[model samples]
Target: MLSSLAAGFGLGLSLIVAIGAQNLFVLRQGVRREHVLSVVAVCAVSDAVLIALGVSGIGAVVTAVPWLLDVVRWAGAAFLVGYGMLAARRALRPTGAALHVETEAPPAERGGRTMVATTTRTAAVLTCLALTWLNPHVYLDTVFLLGSVAATHGAERGVFGVGAAAASLVWFAALGYGARFLGRWLDSPGAWRVLDGVIALVMWGLAFSLVLPVFTG
Candidate 1:
């Protein structure tokens, strides 16, 4: 049981540590200090739920319906493309002023631009949800891959799933909270432009990868 748990934790962390759209969004939010807790909770909880489904043998059902992934693949690609365009726009037309990190400033004092760097809690949460749920690779990694690995543990699969879920929580918490330290560096518009530019490239790259398989396969 201990060995299975350890394996699950290690594998889970490895899968999630990759540079992906969801991770990039979380990092951006963390650096902006905008809805960090909500974003982290959504990501971590969503991973746990998906991991639970996989361990419960739902992966078999998902596999049985190949069309389900097809639909998800197209939708994910579309969403990613749209998001990438938005990021590109931000990068190309950067706000001249540095991002305002001091949240205590009055709306008037902040040049009446409270909405510039920060977003509402609802928007933040919804974006986080879309980024998490709309990515087909997430299902492949957490549900199918992780589930298949857990099955090898036999009766200890449950413990393995728990370990995997725990890893998700730990990773997201550290990533979301730890990114605040980079806030000082992202204070300049040029820095923000570079970050958004990188985000746009990654988003479009993921989108293209998602669709390329359909045409190539």
Candidate 2:
């Protein structure tokens, strides 16, 4: 049971450790220090739910539907392309002073408006949901793939699944909150542009790789 759990934990970490769009978004949020806790918590919770669902026999259903897999593959590829384009645009666009949270005055000084403060939290939650749900690869990774793997363990399946879930929670929480160290270097607009440009390249590369197999085959 322990060995299986360890294997599951390793598998989960391996799946998530890639420098993908979701991780990049989390890292960016960590650097910005904008709703870091909420963002991490939402991401962890979402992953845990999906991982649990995956281990609960949903993998069999997903495997039975090959079309679902194909749909996810194509949709994920397209989303990656779109995100890459957006990142490129940001890199090319002139740097404007976006609202830095630290610079904001107290609500009383700002006309007693609660809208901006509330909106940030709302946006953070929405971003987490969108990031979790939009990418079909997440479903593939957590539900279909990991679930299938856990099925073979029989009695150890529960332990394995829990281990995997723990891994997802740990990784996202660390990435979402622990990445603040990078903020010292990336606080400047120029640094942000450079980082975004790299992200764009990575996204485009992954998208191209996804489609390349189809054409080559």
State which candidate has the highest TM-score. Answer: 1
Q: Which candidate is the best by lDDT?
A: 1
- Tell me the tens digit of each residue's lDDT in model 2 across 87-163: 79878883454323332445323324331222387877775676577667789899988898999899898899888
What TM-score does model 2 achieve against the real structure? 0.80
For each candidate in turn, the TM-score is 0.92, 0.80
Each model's lDDT: 0.89, 0.77
Query: How far out, in Å, is residue 215 in model 1?
Result: 0.8
* Model 2, position 21: C-alpha lDDT score: 72
> What stretches of model 2 exceed 4 Å from their correct place?
98-119
Task: Candidate 1: list runs displaced more than 4 Å.
Answer: 100-116
Q: Report RMSD for candidate 2.
A: 4.4
